[model samples]
Target: TKEHLISVEQGKQYMPTDTTQNSLLNLDLLENSEFSSITRRQFISKWYSFSYWIIFAIIIISYLVYFILSKRSVNPIEIRRRKSTKIAIKRLKNARFCLKNRDFDQFFEEIEKSLWGYFADKFKINSSELSKETIDLYFDKRNIKTETKNNFVSLLNICEFARYSPSKDRNLQMERTLEEAKEIIIEVESDIKKK
Candidate 1:
C-alpha cells in the first residue's frame, strides 16, 4: 500500500546519493592529472647530480693508498744500519778489484771513502765535519771494543798515509789490510749487536 501510494517526485527525493561512484571518479582524476610514478630508467638517468660524489670518492681512495705506501714502517736504526752495511760492502768490493789490478791509489781512496761514508750515514754526520775526533767520540760513547776501535783508527791512518805518502809498498799491504778491514767490520757489527 505504501509503494502504491508514493509519488515519482517524492521517491526521487527520498533516494540516497551514490557516494562510492563519486570517490572513484576523484581517484581516477588524481592519477591521470595531479600525481604520477616514475620508472627505474627515468630515475637512473639523473646521474649528473651524483657524479661529483663518485669522483670525490675515487680521489679519496687514491690518496689513502699513497699515504699507506709512502709511510716508513722500518725502524730508523735498522734502516741506517742496513744502508751503511750495503754501502760498505759495495765499496769493499770495489777496493778489492782495485787491489787485484794493482791500483793502489784508487784502492786506498775507495777504502777511505767507504769508511767516511759509512760514518756519515750511520751517525747522520756531515761529510765536512767527519773528523777522527767525532768518530772516536761516537765509538767511545757506544762502548765499542778497544781492539775494534784501534783497528778502525789505524786503518784510517794507513789509508790516509797511503794516499799522501809517495814511497809506499802497495802490493805487500793489500791482502793483510783487506783482511783486517773485513775483520774490523765484523767485530764492530758484533759489538753493536751486543750493545
Candidate 2:
C-alpha cells in the first residue's frame, strides 16, 4: 500500500543500479522466458534428427566390422589350389633341368612326377593315389575329347616304360616324351582356365 502511494517526485528518483538485477535479466533473456514452451512439431523434429544420427552411426560401424572380417577370411579350396599349382610349376622346372643334363632316367622320373603333379593340381586330386586310368576317366567325364585324353595317357605310359626299359636311344625317347608332356600341360592349363 505504501509502494502504491509513491509521489511523482519519488518515482522520478527510483533509479537503482543493482548488478544482481541486471544479471537476472540477462539470465531470463538467455533462457528465452518470452517463449512459453516448444511446439510438438519442433520437439518431434529434434528427436528424429538425434535418432537419425544414432542409426547412421550404428550402420557405419556395422559395415566397418563386416569389411574387416571379410578381408581376413580365407577360402580353403583356393589355398589348396594355389599350393598345388606352385608345386606343379616347380616340378616342371626340375623336369626341364633333368632333360637339359641328358639324364634320361632322372628326366623320365621328373616328367612322370611333373605330369601327375599337374593333374593333381588341375583336378584337386591326391597325387599318390592317382592312376592313368583314373585320370583318363576324369577327363572323359568332363567331356574332354578322346584323342586329347589318349595322348596324355600314352605320354605318361611312354615315360614309365622309358624309365624302366633298357633302351639304346634313351635321349631320343626323352625328347619325344618331354614334348608330349609339355603339350599335355598346356592343354590341361587351358582346360582349367575354361572351367
Candidate 3:
C-alpha cells in the first residue's frame, strides 16, 4: 500500500484506494496554494508584447515632433531667393547655348528672363512685376557704379529691341548682350561679396 501511495504521489500510477490522498491534495489547492505561478513561455510572450508597443510608441512620437518642428521652421523667403538664383543661372546657360546655335529668338528671351531673375534675386523683388525703371532705381539706391548701371540698362534695351524689332543682325546683338550680362553678373556678385 505504501508503494502504491508513493507511486500515486509521483504521478506514475494511481489506485482507487487513494481517495484520502486525493482529497488532501484538493484541499491544498483550494487554499490558494500555487505549484507554479507563470510558465517561461507565458512570461516571454508578455515581455515581448510590452516591449513591442513601447518601441512603436517611441518611433511615432519622434516622427511627430520632427514634423512639427520642420513645419514651424520653414523659411519661404530664403527658399524663393535660392530658387530664383538657380533659375537665373540655368536660363543664362541656355541663352549661351541658343546664341551658339544662332537661335536668336530663344537667346533673347532667355537672356531677358535671366537678367530679370537675377535682379529679382539681388533686390529681393518679384521678377513678374519688375520693370526696367524699377531695376534702375534699385541699382541707383544700392549705389551701383554709373558704368555698371548704364551697361545693364543698355543690355535690357537691346533684349527688348531685338525681340520686338526682329532684324537679321539680331544674332550679333544677342551675342554682345550676353557678354554684357555676364559682366554685370560678375560685377554684381563682387558687390554682394563686398557687402
Candidate 4:
C-alpha cells in the first residue's frame, strides 16, 4: 500500500517567456534524392520451398497417425475374446482325429475341453469358475440366443455322460454331438459378429 501510494509536490518557478509561430525547416521530403531507391532480396527456388512444405506435411500426418493408433491400441482380453471361436475349432479338429481313430474316451474329453475352453475364452471366465451358471451368466448378459445356449448345454451334457455311460450307439452319438457342437460355435460366432 505504501509503494502504491503516490506523492505529489507543489512548486512554481518562472524566469523568462518567449512565444514563436514561424520557424524555418532544415530538411524537405520532396528534395531528398535517395527517396526513390528500390530494395532487392534473394528468394529461394519454388521447388525447394515446395519440397519443404511437402516434407513438413508428411511428418505431421505420420505423427497424427501414430498418435491415433497408439491411443486405440488393442486390448489383450478383446483379442482373446475375438479369437475364442478359432481356438475352439482348432481343438475340435483334434477331437475329430480322436473320433476317427475310435478313441472314445479321448474324443469325449476333447469335446468337453473344447466346450469349456471356448466358454472360458469367449466369456472371459476363469477355468476354476467354469460351471453352467457361470456360462449362463455371460450368456444372459450377452443375450445369447436360447437355441444356441440349449445346443451348447446339450452337447456338453452328452460329452460328460459319455465318460461313464455305456451306450450301444456311441458312434452315432459322437457324430451327432460333434456336429451340434460345431453348429453351436458357429451360431454364437455369427451372433457375436452381428452385434
Best by lDDT: 4
Estimate TM-scores for all models: 0.59, 0.57, 0.57, 0.65
lDDT accuracy of residue 96 in candidate 4: 92
Assess candidate 4 and give its TM-score to the true structure. 0.65
Worst 10 residues of 2 by lDDT: 32-41
Compute the lDDT for candidate 4.
0.80
Model 1 Cα displacement at 131 (Å)? 0.7
lDDT of 4 by residue, 1-195 (tens): 356878886558743433332221223332353532221111335557888999999999999999977755567776677788889999899989998998888898998999999999998877899998887778877888878887788888889899889478988888887888898889988876677
Per-residue CA lDDT of model 2 for 1-195, tens digit only, reads 355665555576688799999999987776675443455557788999999999999999999999977755566555566676567667767877887887878888888887787777667777676998788778977767677788888888888888789489777777777777777767766665676
lDDT of each: 0.79, 0.76, 0.79, 0.80
Per residue, candidate 1 scores C-alpha lDDT tens digits across 1-195 of 355665555554586769998899987776786333453445555675478788999999999988876654446665665689688878989999999999888988888888877777776777888898987888888888877888898998988887778345668787777777777777777887799
Clashing pairs in 3: none
* Residue 25 in candidate 1, Cα distance off native in Å: 44
Instruction: Report how far off residue 84 is in candidate 2 (Å).
Output: 4.2
Q: Alpha carbon lDDT of residue 145, candidate 2?
A: 64
Among all windows of 10 consecutive residues in model 4, the one with the lowest summed lDDT is 35-44
